[model samples]
Structures are given as C-alpha cells and as structure tokens.
Target: EFARAPGTSDYAHNTFVDFGGVTAKNVRLTANSNWGGMFNQYGLSEVRFFSIPVFAREPSPDSGTTDVDVDVTLSFRAGREAAKHDVYLSTDEQAVIDGTADVTTVTEASHGPLPLDLGTTYYWKINEVNEVETTTTWQGDIWNFTTHEYFVVDDFEDYNDYPPDEIWSTWIDGYGILTNGATVGYPAPDWNQDEHYVETAIVHGGEQAMPFFYDNTGSAAYSEGERTFAVPQDWTKHGIKALTLYFHGDPNNAAEQMYVKLNGSKVTYDGDAANLTQTAWQPWNIDLVGFTGVNLSNVTELSIGLERIGAAGGKGVVYFDDIRLYPLFSAVVGTFSIHPWTGDGDSGISSSKTYTHTGKFTGEGTDGEPFFAGNGVYFERDTNRSGTSWTLTGAANVFGTTNPVTVADDSAALARSFFYGDEDNNHPVLTLMGLLPNTEYVTTFYTVGFGGAGLRFVDITPGDNLGYPTRVDQNGVGSGSGQLIKHTYTATSTEMSFMFDALKTGDSWHHYAFSNEAVSPNLGSN
Candidate 1:
C-alpha cells in the first residue's frame, strides 16, 4: 500500500505509510490521473523510505546522576520491531554516523552494557535498520551521561555556610570548625600551640578542612568524630584499595593514642605518639584487606578517635581534611589455577583462557577468574607498637601433614608464611583492595593454629568497614592440620584484601602458617 495517499483529488499532507511489519526489499508505487481527469501531476518536498531506523530511546539513568556503575544497559522503545540496531558510543561530542566509524549492529532492543570509564562522560546514539539493508527507518538523537567518581570520599566542601546551623552534615564530633583553607588557630596556653590545627592555604584536594582543637585537660575522654553519608560505591570494583585521610597534629609519643573506626567497628590499626606529632599534612592510609564482612556499597559511617589520657595532657589541636576512602591499585591476591596440583610449584599456573583481553594471571574455572592471593592497588600493614610486624610467605613448601590434605600430594604444602611475626602483644594489620562490586569470589587456603587472625572486607568509597569476609579471629586450618581452608566473598568493590595479626605467643607450629591458598571468582560457566 502507498504511504502518502490521502483525501481524493486534494493534496495529501502529514500522511504516513504503515507497512505493518512487512519485509519489503523493493517497493514501487504507481500513480493515477487526477480525479478531474486533468493531466496527471503531483508535488512533494521529500520522498522518504523508512526501513526502520531507531525511532526513540528507552528509559535509563538520567543525565548528570553520580555513582553510576561502569556497566550500563542501553535500551530503546521503537527499535524493538526492527530486525537489527546499530550502537555507537564515544566521549567526543561530534560523534558521526558513517560507514567507517565505530558501530555495532545487534538484533536486540537494548545495546551492550559496554564498559565505561569512571568519573567520565559519554555520548551515544542508535540507528535502526531491516535485515536486508535497504533503508534507515530513523536515526536517534545523541544522548549523554557521566559515570561515578568514587575516588574522593570526603572533601568537606559540600556543606552549608557556618552561622551555627549551617555546618556540614558529614559528622558528629568533638570541638571543631570547618574552614575554607583558612589559617585557623585555637586559643590556649603557651605549651598548647594551635598552629598545628590550622591548615592555612594547604589542602589535599578541595577547599576545606576541619581544624579541631582538643583541649582534653579536664577529664579522661574519647576523641571521636562520626559522619553520616550515602553508601559509597564499591571502590574495589574500580581497582582501588585502602582508605586514606590527611592529618596534621602534634605526636602522642607515649601511651596516649588514637584510632580510626569505620562502620561501628574497631580495627587493630590505631595511632601512637608518632601519629599526632606530625606538623605537616600527610596522608594516613589503612589497608582494607581483612576487615570482617566489609562492603563498600553499604558503608554508613566514618570516624576518628583518640584518648584524653595521652600526651599534651590531651590539650592539642588536629586538622582533618579531605578524608577520601579509595585507592586504585587494581590487583588480585592468589595463585591463578583451577587445580593447584597440576602445575609446577614455583611457576604461577592459570587457565589458558583470556578475558576482555588484557593481562592473564592464573585464571581458570567456570567464570575464567584466577585463584586470588589477594587483589588490590597496593597492600599495606600498620601498627602503633614499635616492634609489631607483618609479611606474606614466599612460595609453597612441601610438608607432611598430620592433618588430611586435599588435591595432588597427600602431604600438605605451605603457600605463605606467618602473619604478624613479631611483637605478639601489639596490633598489626595488612589491608589491600581491587575487587568487583556486588560480585562473588571465593578464597581457599590452608592454615594451622592461626589465632587472633581476624578478617574483614571493607567498602572503599567512604570506607564502610563492615563488608564481606566478616571478622573471623580464630578460624582454624582445615582438619586442624595443613588442610584446605575455603571461604566465599561477595565484595562491594572490584577486589578485596584482608588483615591478620597475632596478639599472643604461638602454640608451637601454630603461629598462623597458611599454605596452598587459591582465590577464584564465581563466574558461572563450565
């Protein structure tokens, strides 16, 4: 049927031809003489043969929204009836529709969840067509949106003005004031210098810092400040690790100390006299590797603490600024292999399969992910005690186990060495990051008599400390001998690391010797 045939003998305007899902290759229409039998004639400005170009875009994330995932779906309303659709994505505004440009044609209403960069903007368009490539029914308009920026958790800059009720809603704490990188000083005695609390024009990232003056001379008090914010996107998914903040204050070189509490839990990491003694702004970072059940997506609070009985008679000032909670050290922790007994003990054995196509570690199994030792941008250990220490073992050592062993050799094999080897009475924690968000991964290893070896997974953005791999302080080696120790982790980030330490003397060979550790992601496939 003809598309523009309308009102007999009169000129046809605003007319449309509906083929009704007809598979037309070549269409031809014959014209007839005018009804008055006058010489046949007609006038039309445009002759359009719509072969099903994309007519409209479907509902999706609105433009300018923050904290969007890297993988997003592109949908449409009109393109569903078409045989195929072409998708184009670009950061450039003037993305063109040409034969030689980047495009993908698929037979679906929605285009790929193409991988996108973090904290970046993108432009996209869709064009619809039929199976037999004859015409373009419609061309979609250019649409754009920005991805999430999970790097800086807190800058203390997005608050209302300070006239009593105009302070930022980020915290509830001791005596303090937010300044626009101003030279803020507190009034105190001669021994009490307030310059340490003043940030002046120095800032880590943004234009604000909280210069807190703690005059703890009256009574023994706890110095703590807490914040209420949105759940930070999983930083591990973005290849970030550890939570960092900038601090400048006088050192508490004695028994007096402070600590950082995340998600209403106390970690082994705390400050000594050295932490408070710093006169210049420095980044204080804590490893997020082994905090129990920590997920960044559900993060709720962040806080800092100190003891009023410590140095300066608890009469000093500390400046806090830009308390960001993410670091991108994209890595996975483990030996990559589906089966450990199948490869050489020294060489890291992973699957022969490739992924989105980049570097290949020991990747195998259904999901094509490798066995993780631990993944993160960087791994770190912190302790306030002078003699405290932590280290990972070199390689797997063969040892006959009194306990039952799985896989290859019936004898047990040691994968890594003792955690927190020295100063049995102090706190030592190892933290790392780099994990996929809302994704599941598993860790299987062997340990013997590993006591006080607490584990916690952390949320990187805004540092929610109560994430995956919950606190397991006294988990034992399988069979109480050198056996396979396995635990599954559903992380809030790209990759997750952990911390372990010993608080007391070991029971013989029971100083937390871990071996044959394999970490794998839950990729569903054969």
Candidate 2:
C-alpha cells in the first residue's frame, strides 16, 4: 500500500510502504524506481486484504450513538498575501466532489469556519492559494475530528456600518469662505460670497467657546506683524484623514508663509500673496500625500498656522469655511480641457476656416457681424480677378458688413476676410484702429506660404497720418511657392497701426491672437 499527502510531488526520497500478500515494509521511493530499485520506472503498488482487521472496538453498554455539530474556525496570517484560503472536505480519497466546493472565500485576514457534523470523523484541508495566480497552490496537513451535534455561543452580534468621521483641513481662509459682519463679530462665514477674510471658527466646541479670531486682531500674537495658527500637538491622535484650505493673495504684499506639523514634523506652504485679488474667491484642496512628513496610513491630526513673510504693507486676508475631516480611499486631482469655438456653439469642428467667439478671417467679414451678443468678431474674404491681375475687393466699413465676400468661385472664391503675407516681400505690417486701448484683444487671420510670419508694430501719435499699408506678401500665388497663411497681433498702444507682409509660404488656414492688450490704429488714419 502506498499513501502520500495531497499535492505532494512524486519525486526522490519520499516515504512509502509496500505489502505483498502478508507483511508490509518501508521502502525508499525515487522518481526512477520503486522499492528494491528493481524497475527503472516507478508506479504505485496496490494492496488487497483477504480479511479486514478492526483497529479498535466500539464502546458497548448498549450505548446509543449521539451526534454533535461543531463550528470550524479559520484564520490567516501575513499582510495582503495571507488573507486568502480554501477549505475542502472529501470522503473517498480518489473521488472528486464538484458541488461540495466552498466558493465563499473570505477577504479579511481572519474569518470563521461554520458548523460541521459530529460523531463522524471528517477529513478537511486548507489550501493557501496565491491570489495573483490560482494554479500555484499549497496545502496544510489534513485534520480529522468529530463534532458534537449542537453548540451555541452567547456573544454573537451583527456588524454595523457607520459613516467615516476622520477629517483634515488645509489653509482654511479666503480661498473658499466669505465674511458677513464687521471686522470683529462675524457669523460663521459663507461659502457663496466672492470676498474672503482671515479667521477661524472652533467647530467642535461650538461658536461660543472659541469664537473666531482674525489676523489683524491684537489678541492673536503676531509673528512679523501677522497672526499664525499651528497644528495641535495631538493632531494625529484624533484620526484626521484629509485637509482643505481657503487662500487669497495680496497683489502688493510679499508671499505669505504657513507651516503645518504632520506626524511630528513641520512643513511649509509658501502662499502667493502678491497675486491675490479682492474681486473673486479661489478654493484650494491639499492632499495629505502633499506632505512628506505626514503618515497617511491613518492620518490622526493636522495643524496650520500663518505668518506675514512679505514686505511691510504686505497685509493679505482670506476667509475659511467648510472645514472637514473624513476618510477617503484616494485623493482627486484637477483636470482641464482646451475649448475651441466653431460657428456652432459646440466644438470639434472639421473645417480649417472655423471661427470661435473670436472670428477666423479669409477676407473681410466672411464671418457674420458680431452676433450672439457680440461675443465674437466677423471675417471676410475677397479674391476678385481684374483681367489677369487679382485685387481683393476692399470694404468701406470692415466691421459694418454682414457678409463681406462678394466674389463666388470654388478656386478663386472669397470665403471670409483674412490677411495673408508673402515671404517674397519684407514683413509689412497691418493695423486696425478704433479699438479699446490697454485692453486684451485677439486678432486672427489666414496667410498662405511662408513657414512662419513675424509682426512689426509702430505707435502712431494722435492726429498723425497713419495711411501706410504694410505688405504681408509680395507675390500672392495659391500654389507655385506661396498660399494661404494665418497671423495674430496683440497691440497695447493708445493709437497704433498694423500691416501684413510675408516671410514664407504655406497653403493653410492659420489662427493667432493678441491678448491682454488692444489693437493699434488703422493704416488709413492720420
């Protein structure tokens, strides 16, 4: 007879026994041969019994058999790897049972084994299967035991679900909150308002306990003339998971400085105070991962304090609101998408000559007049043929025309009013007047040929003759060497002039912009 543990490989030097008709003896087994090393190949030896012998006698006394049920408990060790286990029962060692498979696997590192039959010995084994690969398996020694028919436990209760309570706050002023009352007695700040001021409210003890404090007040000791708040010593003990803050900048002051202690170490966040504007509120969210000293495994507490690090007149204020502490699986990052405008309200248009709230130009006013509440500009195109030569039909009022293109032809068509430059000529300039001075503007037009084009700006004094049309392109050819191109110019002058000439050639619709300033005077004005 031969018996071996389940899943054990039939390799060299495994324990084995052999019985020929009467007696059995221990034998050394190897991959190549059985006992006596007789055969070069190995195979299992079968045993048959002429008469069965009882190992032990059952207890008498006319004792009736009693059945009992016992619950089997299972536990696992190891971090993530130790939590997985498989339980199985079998009677006939050679027969495989399909429906009896226990599919309810436990995810927690420790779990229970349920009730089992008593008075009858049952064979059970646990397999620590690798989660990443199911085929790789390891088995524990089989356990045999009998259970009592019935057993009960008193300390059994259902699990309960509770909302997460841990919370973390970061830079909690002006970035998100708004103050309502005077400098002294303000109610809990509002989040909807556009303005924010510096202050803190004790959420746990009720407003009466710690009333809010402001940076300008004398009670809060000032460091370098600005108030500061530091994280509590027991921050980590409270189970804080995340942090949030509200911040505002002071355009005149130097950057602000704030420090926080995470997991017993202090880290600083340098605030950009010079860029702060009172007109709008900007919210900031800081993740615990943003701090290296903090133990994010289970953040307990966070401390925040601020100081004026900038120049003396660098006073800045921010409002704080919606301070929170909660447990979350992961942090969220911000994302942005580039939005382009076509004639339609939707984006992703296929045409090269598409217009945004700002217009695309082919000639003059090809795009409709500033419709839709004047959110965009109009464009025009003119490729009129005067005998063999070509001259774009000039418009009297560039902005006044509804549909600027007068000529209609597929090859020589005037689609919209756009400017083009010729590399054959020095970069001439083009200017449009009657524009808002010192304001941002976007001037877009198409040019053909030329790899890239440059802009030349000239400031025209009031009452000066500005009647100069700079050449954008010398020889305006569609294919041979030059074609359509685009250019943009940003002008910041009170009165300026612009003209376009080419630096190269390529037949494509181009778009450029002049932002943060206005356009200059036109070529015709003096």
Evaluate model 1: give its TM-score.
Answer: 0.35
Candidate 1 residues lying further than 4 Å off, grouped into runs, are: 1-83, 86-129, 134-151, 161-170, 175-200, 215-218, 230-241, 250-258, 268-275, 293-296, 308-313, 327-526
lDDT of 1 at 250: 45
The residue-by-residue lDDT of candidate 2 on 1-526, one tens digit each, is: 3434244565444443434434223444456434555657555544333422211112111123233234545433422233465555543332213425443445543335554433344544455556564333444444444444212110011111122210112222332223211122133345476212222221111121111223522232222211123432222322333454333232233344545555445555533333233211222334455578555554444444445443332233433333333222122221111121222233222233323223233233323333121124222222221111112212112222233221222221222333433243333333444544443343333222222222211111111112211122211222212222222333344433333322234222122211112223232211
What TM-score would you give candidate 2 relative to the actual structure? 0.25
lDDT of 1 by residue, 341-393 (tens): 21123223224211111111111122223323322111111111111122222
Candidates' C-alpha lDDT: 0.44, 0.31
Q: Candidate 1 local accuracy as lDDT?
A: 0.44
Candidate with top lDDT is: 1
How many Å off is the CA of 513 in candidate 2? Answer: 17
Tell me the alpha-carbon RMSD of every candidate.
20.5, 26.1
